[model samples]
Target: MKDLIFDNFQNAVDESLLRHKSILDIITKLQESEGRINRAVAKSVTNCGCIRVDAKKQELPKEDDDIEQLSNALKTHIEGKLCDSCREVIEHEIGNNLFYLTSLCNALDLNLYDIFIKEYDKINTLGRYTLR
Candidate 1:
């Protein structure tokens, strides 16, 4: 109903989170949401057969290769795109995950945007080393 802005969504989650106010509840719900997301993705590959995971050992680059080279050589192991049904299910599960994540941040008096910015800065600072 509202804009998908981070702070706005965080505030909305804070406002709507009436039942799971306790930190413990929020944490468990968050974990559950994560599990659901995993299940949804699994179903897409296993049941729906919309996508596939050709999971195998990552073909590591040469020892002397640059970080950029290593990054370029990496593979996600996921082949094929998610179908509309699978995408919708996964998106909904991820939305639930975000809801509880925002709830945890709210309970701890932390700003979701601040967390994002801090992580963004860390990644930017450690562009080459962050992989490790």
Candidate 2:
């Protein structure tokens, strides 16, 4: 198989860590990075919601119409260049999500990576329990 490629924002964020000034720098950098990633996710969600509203605005009744509303909304958003409102929505949405996750991690004494690994191993190993 050909070499795999990652063309996503998350990949870019991960790759950026190598260029940091020092290992100590990574701690601060990581906090900033996660905030940014969560923000980006939020914006995309907001854009999707806006698209949905726009699609609903454009709806017309027809006999036996069975198309998914959100899918149609997405098409409308893309075609209409609905970015300004979507951008605001994304910023607010991402900010809130990032804030909550950061707060929860701080309060709960959780290591996201460790938790993720434990869950993933359980998923893969089906009834086999392993000591961490």
Candidate 3:
């Protein structure tokens, strides 16, 4: 099976949706994702056996720290299937993620699609990770 270049492809979803909408369309995708995520979450939890574990005691990072402990911790929990599948909620999260990626690209004067393509191509050619 072919590996997906964008493991979380939803981050770019909003860019496609906004192709025909005005600037205000940015908020549209965000709101849409929020709704979808909510629904998915609700469905997943309806009858699933899930566990919620609090992070072990640890000191908070200092202001100048570059770490994102919370995000990393949440991702670990999610991947561990601490909860069941929530399709509706996942959809919105995917869309909103794409929207943010697109926004970041625009801010940096870069093209997300092109960047992704180029990165993939480089990865394929090198057969391993290497700085571009």
lDDT of each: 0.92, 0.47, 0.53
> What lDDT tens digits, residue by residue, belong to model 3 across residues 27-127?
56556666766656545545553533344555555667544553333332332253324444476577665665565455455666578779788889875
Cα displacement (angstroms), candidate 3, residue 51, comes to 11
Per-residue accuracy of model 2 over 1-132 as CA lDDT, tens digit each: 111221232233344434443544545555665667665544555645433223345554464654444334333333333367666655665654444443344335454445556778796896323322
lDDT of 1 by residue, 77-107 (tens): 8999999999999999999999999999999
Judging by TM-score, tell me the better candidate of 1 and 2: 1
Per candidate, the number of residue pairs that clash is: 0, 1, 8
**What's the candidate order when arranged by decreasing TM-score?**
1, 3, 2
Lowest lDDT 10-mer window, candidate 2? 1-10
- Model 3 clashing residue pairs (backbone): 11-97, 11-98, 12-98, 33-92, 36-88, 36-89, 37-89, 40-89
* Candidate 2 global CA lDDT score: 0.47
Better of 2 and 3 by TM-score: 3
Query: Which candidate's lDDT is highest?
Result: 1
For residue 131, model 2's alpha carbon misses the true position, in angstroms, by 27
How well does candidate 1 match the true structure in TM-score terms? 0.92
Looking at model 3, which ten-residue stretch has the lowest summed lDDT? 71-80
